[model samples]
Target: MTLNSNFREAYRQAQSQDVIGPNVIPKALPFVGGGLILTALGVYGGLGVISNYPNAFMPSFWVALIAEIVLFFVARNVAEKGNNATATPILATYSLLSGYTLSAIILVALSTSGVGLPGIGIAAGGCGITFIAARQIGSNLSDRDGMALAQTVQLGLIALIVVLLGQLLFSLFGIYTPGWLEFAISGIGVVIFAGMAVVDFYIMPRSYKDEQYLSAALGMYLTYINLFIFILRLLIAINGGGRD
Candidate 1:
């Protein structure tokens, strides 16, 4: 499981050969811009529950989840079909979904008790780091060597284990896993997802032909989705689900 070699090679490939089209820039810029825009809207929509209709805030959680699911398929289909134009919209939809999901989790934290300052701080810090990483990945207007075959296979297995463990833990407790355990799980999830981003970034350009740009967007979307979900779980862990 190695990334250094493949990642460097991918970089060289980009430098020596034009793997992307001119429309890649035009298509990708909007993905970045639109992602940011939707993120802002989702954040506002989810967190705007400072007063008035507090109960109104709850539905946004489901809305965000459903939106993510929809966009996932849309992006997958577009890439399958070689439609680069759909890239920006797909990214935008996923970004909004992420912002909305985070907003819901933050609301959950506020609604619950016993979370305290330390928990909030840790969650916030992790989330900030994840956000920055997302930006770095999205702005990767170029590609290069990617994860080795071993690393790619390992990441897939790790992701599967993490997801299964998370589900089992949740089912057992009827909620998120408790305390530092949750944070550890989430932290690992973030790292794995980040690795997936690098792998996907390289895979898109190297594997797909006409759909290179769209595939890039899809890879970036998956990265964000995995990162945000794990980070949200980490926050829930710190919060301790109040008295429940």
Candidate 2:
């Protein structure tokens, strides 16, 4: 997803910084947790509308998706200026809308046999596991190792985006991705974003000053959410396209 195009900006800024904000991750953790909670609430609300007011779901979903795109850029801009009071709410709202738009995928997971709540749980759990490992390894990286990993992740992201665009263009022409290709793409996405989880730790401290924790939070939130998304996609692909 282009949802994290903002991260490239963060990565660019990280290259120039010689100092790291050792406290930023600790400070940003609460907001990350809060944003995620809001996201869950939004998902709950979206599921209700989808279940009970099916006719409105698609229209409302497109609006929410567009709003999310707008809010993300606005929040990042404000956060970069250190306007925490303004940016915090915008990021929160963006998180909520993000979950709302994700309802369609979650609904598909819910419908697939042997891949309902368990699949969702597993995807979420996978992100939590990634965070634990990333925190340890990402924090202790030698300077050379850190730079090398960052370069690898950057190239991976660029290549992944190109493949994804190709997939989208083909779908628009009624040439949807075959099941095996879908599985392969989603699996690669899982690997790429898992690498990103590590990079966020190494990059955030270098990219942001103490005042810009919201930006860090936004980046961290994007990492895990995208991880969640790709994991869910992998699950759906593995289960044979959400239904028989």
Candidate 3:
């Protein structure tokens, strides 16, 4: 049988089980944990970047946005062709290239602002470890056969609507959220990420080919990254202990 056929059969077996379905849970964990880590990184990275070299940092934000859009299409094509393994490697390459922007932000945060390097380092280390763990766990599941084109479009729309609406509300208020609110945001973000991970993990294996692993990885990576950032923001907002 072709890899695609094998992938479908395996997923069928995985889907048949009880208890949240093996096909679903592994993906769920990473989305929650990963999103928290990424969110934290984004906050620190943005703050750090703006603090050290304000101009360079902000532009990368736009650039990262564009890159994500490009990759989204690439991932979709790769998955349609049954190339899961290839998808992840390609995504890693993009991530490596794109990561520099965030790294620049991180460098600025740590070196320019001496707020608390040790604490940040500890948190950063923990986030990295968690990501590695999640990737490994989720990868163990059988491959997804492929999602319907409509489902893919629907998922993208859901993400866009949520993000745009959330940001709009925040922007309209000009509300610098209070410190305690951070925890609440983080808690909510965790729940969202967990659900996202479950959805992605279940969907990816069935829809994507082995060559599309990179694409799936990218999807997984973003989910975790978002989660991380939300968690981090919560931490910073709260830990500051009642901002000025």
What's the distance in Å from true for residue 177, model 1?
1.5
Task: Name the lDDT value of residue 237 in candidate 3.
Answer: 47
Q: Which candidate is the best by TM-score?
A: 2
Candidate 1 segments whose C-alpha is farther than 4 A from its true place: 1-30, 49-51, 86-91, 108-169, 172-176, 228-244
TM-score of each model, in listed order: 0.61, 0.96, 0.53
lDDT of each: 0.54, 0.87, 0.48
Native-structure RMSD, model 1: 7.1
Question: Which scores better on TM-score, 2 or 3?
Answer: 2
Question: How many steric overlaps are in each model, in order?
Answer: 8, 0, 44
Clashing pairs in 1: 6-145, 6-146, 7-145, 9-145, 10-144, 10-145, 11-144, 11-145
The most accurate candidate by lDDT is 2
Alpha-carbon runs more than 4 Å astray in model 2: 242-244
> Which 10 residues in a row give candidate 3 its minimum summed lDDT?
1-10
Per-residue lDDT tens digits of candidate 1, residues 82-122? 76666556756677776776665556666656553455456
Report the alpha-carbon TM-score of model 2 versus the true structure: 0.96
| Ordering by TM-score | 2, 1, 3
